[model samples]
Target: MCVSVCVSHGICRSLSLCVYIYSNTHSGGGLRWQMAEFTHLVVVKFKEEVVVEDIIKGLEELVSQVDIVKSFVWGKDIESMEMLRQGFTHAFMMTFGSKDDFTAFQTHPNHMQFSATFSAAIEKIVLLDFPVVAFKTPQ
Candidate 1:
């Protein structure tokens, strides 16, 4: 059996945490659980002539305009092995309460409008979405 519970975000619509539990029969029938959050990862190499700050500002605006966007964090690659950088200079990670919320964000009018402008400013881009299975640190 599997179970999921939304523990927080009753008052704050922008942030939430959900716990999922799975029974493991092989491990003496014990239960295992994980914190599940849907994550949208964007890695980009912006056009040399485009103003990157404007793009960042637009992303910040997205979090504010998009209600389903639980949290937004982004950064430039500071120190990584040159060969491993893969021509990607920056990364943006957006967390959502669930994949359904992300789908809503994708179809939102504001996102569609921003996407067109954002896509034009990028020389290269990679977008990935996945369920974040995070484990708590044992204390």
Candidate 2:
């Protein structure tokens, strides 16, 4: 049997060795545990004339509509070395509580609706999904 504990976002672990550590504060002012968070990462190169602000707005709307989304962030590339960028100018990352949660987000109606518009604006895109692991620092 496996067991785990949660204490104000402090370290928690299962007997099977699934471990979690605190990383950031939640909106309610308590530290949020690392948990088994799964991340959805996307890098994109937009077609010319695509307004970036619209993309950001649509993505933000999805996070609001999807309860399973734990956190969301996006940004434009600002790398000084253009050679390394490979023409991908923007990136988005979303964190879900678990792999199951991530899957739910994928099929969620809000996601489906948003993806249609989002995909059309992209000239090129790459997506990666993974469980967060191996943080460099511990709290």
Candidate 3:
């Protein structure tokens, strides 16, 4: 977890916030996502009646159709002792090269369309845009 992203962006406005780092390597092979200078993290908590699977599929489709997103990945929470999570269960982290790129993504018609449905299902959300400072990789 990388705290700097959340802190620098004032996401959750705390240093102790849990930060999830994006993986460079692809799950199927060694191919890596194009390295970007910035990363945007989005965590969402859906309402009780919201179907989690539907939300995941919508995100996958939205990202697949959006070129502005340099890379995208998501997963569900397993189990954690940390209590700050506040019942948030799903997270999506996407990487983009520039603020302009991210802005474009935010305003994209496709994204806007997707958000209508996504937003209605979400109960709460925490978003963080992280600027890469320094990272270590396997040697």
Best by lDDT: 1
Q: lDDT ranking from best to worst?
A: 1, 2, 3
Off by over 4 Å in 3: 1-36
lDDT of 2 by residue, 16-66 (tens): 234465554545655444456688999999999999898899899889988
| lDDT of candidate 3 over 27-136, digit per residue (tens) | 45432222234688989889999888988898889889987676788988888555977888888998776677887888899998998998899898999986644333
In angstroms, the error of model 1 at 104 is 0.6
lDDT of 2 at 13: 28
Question: Which lDDT value does model 1 have at 139?
Answer: 35
**Model 2 segments beyond 4 Å from truth?**
1-4, 10-35, 137-139
Provide TM-scores for the models. Answer: 0.79, 0.76, 0.69
Q: What's the lDDT of the predicted structure labeled candidate 3? A: 0.71
How many clashes show up per model? Answer: 0, 0, 0
Number of the predicted model whose TM-score against the real structure is largest: 1
Better of 2 and 3 by TM-score: 2
Better of 1 and 3 by lDDT: 1
